[model samples]
Target chain A: MRVTYHAVYLFLAAMLSTTLFTALKLFGVSPNLFIIYIVFAGFYVSKTEAIWLGLVFGFVYDIIVGANVGLNGVLYMFACFLVVVSCENVIRRNNAVVTFIFTAVWTAVLEGINAIFGPVSGVWPAIRIIIVEIFYNGALAVILYLALKRIFERLYDNEKR
Target chain B: MRKLFGNRIFVLLLTITISVSVVLGVINATKTKSTFMGNVAMVVITPLSDACTWVGRKVSGFFGYFGDIDELREENEKLKSEKKELEAKIRKSEGTDRENKDLRALLELSEAYPSLELVSAEVISRSASNWYESFIIDKGTADGLKIGQGVISGENVLLGRISDLGSTWARVTVLTDSGHSVSAKVIRSGDLGIVEGDLSLSKDGQCRLSFISKNSDIVVGDYLETSGLGGVYPKGIEIGKVIEIKPEVQGISQYAIVETSAEIETISKVMIITNNPAESTAVGEE
Candidate 1:
């Protein structure tokens, strides 16, 4: 994918994450679009490019959403690193189930890190948050991943491996 | 594997980024004031979020109007009766006000406390993070909104205070945030206690008033107001009403759960008190 397409997706994800997702909270939880974006980037981009994308998106999300700076960045960067590294060794299966599972795993890992280091109310709330995000973000990841895959395939069929 | 580690510059950049991020996270988490980068980020991001919030509210409001017609009619009838009663009281109040003006002048009570200086601001967005109970307002340093200025409902109910700001935006940490604490008193009993946010209660738009002496005659439905012990907030602002009371686990004291008159979750606009009367009193004492 081109850098311009990456930038547009990142901006849209950041905007929706901070605004619409906030108002649409269910049981005090919202779908994390950034995690979905990170998952998308990991599969489509090189390791270095994915890492940079995650780092920038995380920092931007933190600044927009959190009083505590850099926490999201670290979580996102680590998530991207893991996702990219896994992709290198793991089979590149372009399917909804695979995308959902990948997103669910990363969502749990990232939220777990956030719960430990972030100001979570208690163990129960943290557990609830992780479970909700895993399902919500995993479901979103499947739909978004499929849509983006179709769009990218149509735009640059030869470029897609 | 050797090639991955061989890129010294990439490794160095990664290390530096992580180190800086950790330092910044620690600093921002610990500090009360806004950091430079935070302000910069707010400047860039607030406009986008604010615009999105505006659109979201408009769209929601349009849809909500159709759904709310029945509720609005019921409320309108209730208000019609209340207005008639209020009009009758106003006539009686005008005569009492004339008599009290003379007594007020003699006591010089007005000199003891000044009226609040407030600025109206619309809430642009709420905190995206679940951990923090806060919201962004469109007014900021440009509008003379200082950190710690109290944000309140139109009826003067205490909501929160400005925790941080950019030139065009400010973040108000609500009373339900775990980090927020204030000294408040029961209006009915004059019993003083500390009002603070608990993570458990906050989700339900409730806070707790702790350290109430076990002997005090506090009850559910009692009103609570700021005691003005803390200089950060002005005195006499209504915090909330006590909905429940419970003895402390240790049996030494008790606490009361407070529910604000206006629901914190649905608040869309608020007034920011630019001046702290308590601070002015301290300055006068000094």
Candidate 2:
């Protein structure tokens, strides 16, 4: 089998997610980088590819982090599929604002789905945590997306030349 | 029909991944011994986690180096003064040690119980993401730790249990985690209740005791300890204290907010109970 650049990108994304998770946890914050990467991949990659990346990342995440087995896989796959289906109609743009909004919405949806699976006490506090996490992760997503966009755009331009 | 079959490779990969994961889950759930998988997981994840932690520490240190020199000097002086005071205390403590040697000796008292064996280990890694609640310890099966072993810190305060045991590492699920539960008793009133976890309560570094009797005279300051009823943990290990007791409006039970004695975030050394009578009985009697 031919080794693909997509596989390399996915691996790099997983490693980046690990670093981001550790960094955020040090600051007493929890940011879902796997979810963010999956959403970003869904927007940029094919639906099938997005789902595959999500599953790979989710399984690696589950093994490293002990969560309810298959929970992250299911959540990531569903989230990526949703984003991929939605982004097909939406035109691709280099707008940071759009990326910010998408990140916030994605984070909120992921947290909402997680709350449904787990025992969440006091809805208001849970909602507050979800909002704070969304804002934190949304800001992170903006920075990461801008950087990756520039890099990928440069590479594509070079390839064309 | 063409569109349906367009993503056949992806669908096939997804099917295989899900099937394999399901099989792994079933095997994990049924297998009584978690040593093999636990070892493999430790070998795979620990080095990565350690490297991440190292990078985090380096980054934090790099940022911290930009602090004002005056502030740093002041902090240094304060630490020196505190060290001097500690040194004086140590000297004085040695002189008066003979008179009150046995007083408030929790460790010695804990040693009187033959069913308990303690193996100390350091917390090497904490949970990486917010989704999971677990910690990895430095010592593992090589240190006499096995799956289902109870862990405690700071004067026998219950931390969690060893959920996964490897050859040289283990994973501990803290009592503040949503997935953990323990059969606990009110130390003051001798009332039995179940201690469940709320990850939200972890902000205040506390756990919750649920299913407490409404009629039970559990005051705000009442102590809570393990009941040893579940055969998981030994009896009389301090868990926490009742900080708030709210009787449920509908049920005959009250809910308690317990402030854990062990500082979960700051704890470095933990003792794993290896020779509990309950565990031995469960294994031998079975």
Candidate 3:
């Protein structure tokens, strides 16, 4: 029995989301990991799949942590759609540096929009948080990309046999 | 135009999905039961959260044991000195015995309320995903804990409410959560306002108090306590201290920084305040 790409994607997404959540709690930080997952989805999954995943994750997030319902779902869906559509012109490459840069940019954009429209207080402090979080998550994305790329390549090679 | 419409199935599907989600979201926003889904989702995620907390605790415990011996000793010494100072103050107060007798009378000034039936519980789990802000307590419905019950630290500081209660466990939404807010008052001055948690502020182990009047005489180190206006929390429980106050810009209400009394990282025992004021009053009358 071979694991499909979709299955791998789902597993990775869940793993990344859970890991990010646990890590944040352990360290008392709250950066958006769903946005990072959405970025990863945009790069790996088809546009249709990415949209659905975005909506599902967003709805789940809203149900989990949102003060008011639908706020996070709406934002997440829009962010996923934007990332998927925008990445259409860019050549697909799975390099660590590239993934890091893309994740950082997307994370910043999502956080920036949330800062403006989300329920954050004290916008000036939020700006500083965004900068530090972008750097932290950017470094994490680079490490994650390299590790995942190796794993995927090995899986692909095993499938050839 | 026909070809464009035919080829836009993905776009069309996306539109339908977004619309349905928005409509569902809107319905959730309008109803009190919107929290139902959140509670259910928390139940589904509890096991994962438990595992993560277990791992996190072990890791922290391992490192903390090695790192904090000297610091702990220093803190112990300071606490000893402070205890001695407090003892001296107690001895110096000539009316201390009379004041002890008047303690219950002062509590009655806030309006006689029910004596709470508190069940102590330990935090057994914390959030495992970035999406939810929750922790699991060992006590649950079996322990007479109920949803909407208030959880308090040892110092009577408000922690959060029990959002989901199961047979053997319950999930608590910490006050430091982004969605949490409590009606609070300055304990010394009776100045009423709201204390809210900002995700960003949590980074520094603090929360924000907003909507205070510009003229309110709040200063650093003023004690904040629950106002009991919302019926969710009891009055006179210590919440935090005012660490910083920023005046509102151009006629806006003032905001203050609060360092929460309960250490978010090191909480071990918490009490569930199960009695509502009416029930508390009934018990008091009895």
Candidate chain B TM-scores, in order: 0.72, 0.71, 0.69
Q: Cα RMSD to native, each candidate?
A: 7.6, 7.3, 8.3
| Winner by lDDT between candidate 3 and candidate 2 | 2
Query: In model 3, what is the error at residue A16, expressed in angstroms?
Result: 8.1
Q: Write the candidate numbers in order of decreasing TM-score.
A: 1, 2, 3
Model 2, residue A45: what's the lDDT? Answer: 62
Q: How do the residues A1-161 of candidate 1 rate in per-residue lDDT, one tens digit apiece?
A: 47788778877776676666665666667788888888766766676776777888788778766665777786677667657666666746456887899899988877786666666556886787788879988888887876878766665566463
Query: Candidate 2: how many backbone clashes?
Result: 0
**Fnat for candidate 2 (0 to 1):** 0.16
TM-score of each: 0.80, 0.73, 0.70
Clashing pairs in 2: none
Highest TM-score among the candidates is held by which one? 1
What's the CA error at residue B271 for candidate 1, in Å?
1.5
TM-score of chain A of each: 0.89, 0.77, 0.71
**Which residue pairs clash in candidate 1?**
none
Model 3, CA-based lDDT? 0.64
Better of 1 and 2 by DockQ: 1
Q: Which CAPRI level is candidate 1?
A: acceptable
Please give, for residues B52-146, the per-residue lDDT of candidate 3 as tens digits: 55566556555655567799678768877779777556546734543343343334422333376667776765553332356667777778877
